[model samples]
Target chain A: MATQIRELIGNHKILPVSMERVRDEDDLYELGMTSFASVQLMLALEEAFDIEFPERMLNRKTFASISAIDRSVSELVSGRA
Target chain B: MNVAVNPAALTTPALERMARVADEVAARYAADVDATGRFPEETFAALKRERLLGCWIPKEYGGEGLSLTEICGLVARLGQACGSSAMIYGMHQIKMSSLIQHSVGSPWHLDYMREAARDQLLLGSATTEGGIGGDLRNSICAVEVVGDRYRLTKQATCISYGRAADAILATCRRNPDAASSDQVMVVCRKGDYTLRETVDWDTMGMRGTRSEGFELVSEGDARQVFVQPFSEIAAQSMLAMAHIIWTATWYGIAADTVVKAQAFVKAEAKKKPGTVPPGALRLAEVSASLQQMKSLLVAGIARYEEALADESLMNTLSFIAELNTIKVSASQLGIAIAQQSLMILGLAGYRNAGPWTIARNYRDLLSAAIMINNDRILGNTSNLLLISKIDVSVA
Candidate 1:
């Protein structure tokens, strides 16, 4: 899941910085992830995992980092199971 | 005058009142308004007097709370009389609809809506910024926060009727540290903001809109910022309503041109006792196109109304793609109808001073595709088509 999240972020054009320099704990916004880009990433993640982010999960903190997104998805997937 | 009223509807009286006002105010001032390239003050005054400016605000907020279909109908009627007035009014309703849908629970926005209802305030939008490559979702300006108050300075690409508007809704970076696309929508009243002209309003059509660029500086309470994410607002309400209402207005322009063409055909036939005028056949063809345009608009509006009722559906990828397609189709069809009408009218339509002159309609309808750029819409649609799960072909 973490590998997939990292791969998605790496390919998202909105994140202009090189993916090699980005750490799992790095703040996506600080790394140049725009709100519009974050929404795009969120959509991409949802498609990959087949999980919808509820309204409560739509905040800056949810997409703060790849690790954060991975945790959110894991929790949602586990809860559904 | 006993008109049939739908039990589930609330717009009968409102629509009738708007029609009367359109004739008295919009049509009355339209020519001079266009000639001078000035704001349609008389039409706006009539709207305020009839309290139609706040038609979309909820009844609890002191508005009639008309449905999307009714608002589109009213805008279409106004468009027939004055395209400029209809566009301005439609833009205002678009902003109001966003606030109502996204910030309804916030006390500040609720009070703002009530105040707008009480004062009939005209709201202007400053979303398009200079040096942003015409992207509405990104802003070059950033809002600076000093304690509880925030200050914003933006080089707005255009603010339609900016000087005359009671308040302006400006977009900027959420905070000084936020990303270029992490934006907030702030409502700044007239006294709170000052404008310096950056661009002029001379244009080929919709001259009465008076859209001009300006350097805007404003300060307001931090709470005036909308709480919802700008992305959510854009996807759920702003894009859909703007496209729908603008399409409605363009439909109005085409429908009116067709009406005048039909009148001209009848007048020409009267010259020769029993023979049909050659232009009548062309008019018939254009009228068929006009019907198709109306059907497209109606179908789009129905889809939007359904989304309004179901909040969850609005966030889906397929729905957004569908809305974009509607905009592209409407923009293309509007120009086609206007061009066909001009062909039908021929020399009469070509002349600026004749009864069949559709010069203004032709010019104004041309702005539909270029305003948001249909190419951009199609590009976005292409991307969404790859990922959208719903098969749009089924229905």
Candidate 2:
């Protein structure tokens, strides 16, 4: 899941850093992930993980970092089951 | 495509009465204000006498508790008589909206709102700085806090009616060492701050706005600063209100141009028995374009009201993109519409002195597109729209 999240992040060009240099716990916003890119990343994550983010989950904190996205996607994917 | 009812009931009678006041007082001084490039003191005095300046403050705050839509209506009427007065009123309301929405935990702000309401104090804004230009999200100046007191000095790029306003809401770095984006809004009351004129405002129009540069120096209690982040305050209230209210005012300028053209066309037709004047057809086309402005602005207001009801959608890229589009479209059309009105009325409209003169309208509408710079708005919106899903809903 972490690898796939990183893959999505890299593919979407959400952050300025290359995936190799980026850590899962790095704050994407601090690393120049703008609100526009974050939303684009959110769209990319939903398609890759096959999970829709609820209104409560649609916020800055939920997508603040790669690990945060991993946590949100995992919870949503499991909750659907 | 859920069409939401307007949250506030701004009736036609109230709007008409307010329009009468605008036409009677604002119109009386508008020419002189524009000629001398000064604030419309007479118009504001009338608005104060009517207690309309504080009409938007919540009734609990000793105000009439008029809704945003009502205030927009009032602003549109004011624009018909004087664009500068309308611009100033919309701006003050923008700052007022900020105060009302952000004063949740701040006792000083709440008390100040009551004071502003009771005294009908005129508020102004200083968002643009010397170095930043039109970029409002960043600020170079920081509030220096020592103990319970803080001091700030900023090269304010443009302050609308700076010398005449009762208070000015200025944005600054959250702390001395905070990042440029980490900012807070501080209320600088009349006696607390000193403004030194830094630049002159001799523009093509909106001359009555007297929007000049000033070096703002102020000291106040630390509580004078808002606890909420300036970014959040801007997104939630400031940007939305500014765009909507300004569009309404721009719409008024366009609408009034159409009215003048219609009158001119009617007079020309009367001069010829049973024959339509050539200008009448142009008037029809101009009125039709004015309808487009009306539809776009009304729908934008509906979308904004709907978004305001939904917390999740407040900061969404979709809503922000739509807001930017509304400004771009309204401003572009405002200039075009005023130009078309001039075309319909010809030399009479072009002249500086006439009942049908739209020279002021043309020059004022010209200020719309460049107020925040449409190119910059489009540049920002282009990025937002890239990730946003296009929802095709006509209803």
Candidate 3:
């Protein structure tokens, strides 16, 4: 999950936020995830985990931080994706 | 013949019978047509026979008088079977529809409409100039309209179906001396124009679409002026058409990708030694993406249908915004699924089923998103959203 987050953050061009500082519930938008970047991140997450992130997960909250993205990935992986 | 095999051909039934016949033959012809970069003569004949081309023209002026939704559904299906054929047909439809609505009280307008409906003549759009970026609404192509005639000279870039289309719908800005739409879609016959192939587009996707640039010069009674301002109406109409008409084709392509990927993954799993197969994960991903794409398409179609019923729906910024978003999402999702399918299938997906089959389609499908007005749609959507303060609702 951390690797996935790092890759996503790297691809999204998120800067100034250290990977070490990223918490489970930290707002990704606050860390510089624009709407367009968020969509790209969502796509990356879907591709990474081989799961479908439902429309409900389109909210910024779901991708707020490392833990949130990880939880979503887990849900999708375990029949909830 | 498996008559019920494709219920869409029978149930939805295009404005004409030939469209269904063409639809039946499309799955077969698409492979060869794309392979050779040749227009599907059979499908074009089918469309002509069914009078599907006349659907966009007004009933009073020798047309089927169909709604834009019906027209979009028909073209979308056509786009599914053959991308080249769809591109050619779409160009014709846009010209025909715009001409019918915009050409009023012009002496030769009715005559042209009559020929368009009955003659099976196809139209092509030429607006993209080589040096100049494709901004159709603000084109540099010049037209000098005098009394009842217009003299036009345009260096149009990458004219799709340029060689095959009967007439070219060239967008030109009226000379400073004459009144112009800044962008006017004019109907010029093949003889009236000159085609000088600029560059052979040997590309990865949408390869079969012979989209080479051409030079056009029509000095005589080459074009009948459209009554409506092309800038305002054509842009909006083209966007709406692009958004709705191509939905079915994209859906079909993505659907095919998912199915093919699934089969490959399943086959790989069967050969695996008691573990989750190498291809299983990718197959599942594609399947899920396909589901999302389908849902989004269905929802977008519903909104598009509603907009057709009430033009005021277009004024709703969210509606327009969602339309572009849908297009971008569908394009990306389709490309993603195709890439994943290719990865899972490995060598098989790369090889042609025959000499001229899936190889070209995989290439042609990639060009769908990069067509003229693609960027404009996104930019316009952003502007609208910024002004309206409304979130685009995809669902």
Highest DockQ among the candidates is held by which one?
A: 2
Candidate 2 residues lying further than 4 Å off, grouped into runs, are: A1-68, A75-81, B1-17
Q: After superposition, how far is residue B255 of candidate 3 from its true place, in Å?
A: 2.5
* DockQ of all candidate complexes: 0.17, 0.24, 0.01
lDDT of 3 by residue, B1-395 (tens): 00112234223446445346545876668777766666577776667655566656776776667766566566656665666666566667766666665567665767887777666567777777756756555566677878767888778777877787777777776564322224556778778767777667555655455777777777557346565545535534665556655655666665666666677777776888587878788887778887887777777768766766766455354566777888877777767767777777777778878321344546666766776456766876665444334554444
True-contact fraction per candidate equals: 0.05, 0.14, 0.00
Instruction: List candidate 1 stretches off by more than 4 Å.
Output: A11-14, A17-81, B1-12
Pairs that collide, model 1: none
Better of 1 and 2 by TM-score: 2
State candidate 2's DockQ.
0.24
In order, the first chain's TM-score in every candidate is 0.94, 0.95, 0.78
Find the candidate with the highest TM-score and give its number.
2
Model 1 Cα shift for residue A50 (angstroms): 13
Please name the candidate that would achieve the greatest lDDT relative to the true structure.
Answer: 2
Docking quality category of candidate 3 according to DockQ thresholds: incorrect
Better of 2 and 3 by lDDT: 2
Stretches of model 3 off by over 4 angstroms after superposition: A1-81, B1-12, B15-24, B58-60, B104-107, B177-181, B220-223, B262-284, B312-319, B354-358, B373-377, B392-395
Docking quality category of candidate 1 according to DockQ thresholds: incorrect
Provide chain B TM-scores across all predictions: 0.94, 0.95, 0.80
**How many collisions per candidate?**
0, 0, 6
